[model samples]
Target: MPNMLLGAFPIGTKSGANNSTSNNKNGKCKFLLLCGGYILFLILGAAMFSAIEAPKIDAISKRVQSFRKQFLQSNACLNDEDLEEFLKAVITANDRGISPLRNATNEMNWSFGQAFFFSSTVITTIGYGRVTPLSQTGKIFCIIYAAIGIPLTLVLLSAMVERLLVPARWLLGTFNSKLGHLYQPFNIRLLHLSAIVFIVITLFFAIPTAVFAYIEPTWGALDAFYYCFISLTTIGLGDYIPGDGVSVDNRSMYKIFISGYLICGLIAMMFMLTIFYDIPQLNLGQLFTESTNGETEKLHLSSNNTTCYSGPSGLYMPQRDEDTRRAIVRIRPHGDDSPSPDEAPSSLNSGIRVP
Candidate 1:
């Protein structure tokens, strides 16, 4: 009995150890899943908010605009007689109660405002339903128009980005090659990222901001910068709009010019994002994925950063060393009981050494 008990002790101890380790792993996995679920929830909530909030704000803004126009017209005649008449007319109208809602026809004078709005929608890809093409021909044409124009705009932006990426990649390489010994790979990548950000601010933001301020009436430097910032981000509040300076005789030409400006500006901003992606460190979260491998991993982030795992080889490198990090991954036996480095056995005893 004593001998039997002695032999069983290690087995029982190992079994308990295994259970503990398994529980730890399961706990980790559960925590990760919960975190992922929370992130997904936030993303969905944000998208829903954006879809609903924008149109509601736009409706409120239109109402405010109408009220402002009425106020200005009333204030135009401040003298006693005209003021009294205007006040009486406003009082009578208020008593009768103006329609709280406007039909599409009533907002015709605000069409130019909606053009600025359409420009914003185009950039953001939001295309809300409140204002739309009234004529059948216009409606049919709009569908075909967006299909072609959106892709063409994307292509133009992508091509420009490709061109810009070459120089950006080269610059990063030069910095890495020269200062590699002085810093960790991540540090070098950070320096390179800073350079790109500096260029983006100087070329796309500051200069354009200055030019816009000079050209547009009612725009100071801050307002111009705000317009450029909002338009580039595709927020497009549609307030502080431009190109209203042209006389009524040249309205069509003015509209065309404004349309061209918005499109070109939007494309240029997209190209800036492309240039930003050329920096590997900034893109680490996005680029980490399952399909990536040893050779491809060496391309940018892999080349500079130290991988933390060695798989079966027991060599610890950078996090990017493993391919498909973002991919849904499952660990299992490779058939011969030979454990892949990624699935090496945990140190705890009694746990099934599946790897």
Candidate 2:
């Protein structure tokens, strides 16, 4: 009779054990494929970027070499030794406002206006490095300033982003009201993200690129766009800066205005990134985590009871009241009629007992 009962109730095998294993394997495969596809996309992007930029870089190099050859040939007085001496003089003259030539007015570097711009850049973590603090005292002050400034800047930007999210959420809600019935939530999210991206590109990138190209004679539209991208991304490659190559009458004011532009652009970028990360479907961080049985875990809450599940998946699954009660009853002692204070209420209608 015991053998028959044992045979009737299976002990080792589960109902959906094979299906669960298969789903996990499929999820892992999908994750790997997603990763591989992303890697390939990056590789292709890099290749295309190199293909477009390489010729321009090569042309610039050739022009530089040609200019150097002509300069050396044209100047009968400047031999290799004289060139070395001239470069040394130029280096020494840097930040000192002294001209390497016989008679020239000192460049107004480290002026109050320029210093203010530099401080703004440092606080924003832009650090273009085109103009840097040279003196020991200045360096020490910069260290102290940045130590205090970085966090303050972050707090300010975060507050600004939080405020901006009101309009952003309004736009999302509008999109949902118009299209939610027709499309999935993920599609609506993408549409919202695309709209934000459009706004950012139009305001920060396209208009700025046009303005920069118009103001800076040496910078074409592409160069201006590249500069904007680098600066907004905080890459600060320092290869291209505004109001630096040209001799503008109000250089200090130009620097101050550009500083304001950088700050605004950074704020817009931060807001866009915050919105992007809020969408779970697009978050890349999930790739590194373990996969579950093909279903994404969702949370459910009740007024009186709470239950959670855990496994290799690192996902949170909700349990029904009946399931919760059964689990608790199965685990508790057979004679124990009442649950302990730590135990969650069996049903949403039941009141949670206090100790």
Q: What is the C-alpha lDDT of each candidate?
A: 0.57, 0.75
What TM-score does each of the candidates earn? 0.48, 0.68
TM-score of 1: 0.48
Across 273-351, the per-residue lDDT of candidate 2 in tens digits comes to: 9999999988876654545622433222323354443344533334665555433322333444565444556632333
Which parts of model 2 are misplaced by more than 4 Å?
1-79, 91-107, 290-355
Alpha-carbon runs more than 4 Å astray in model 1: 1-132, 245-264, 278-281, 284-355
Backbone atom clashes (below 3 Å) for every candidate: 13, 0
RMSD of 1: 13.8
What are the candidates' C-alpha RMSDs? 13.8, 7.6
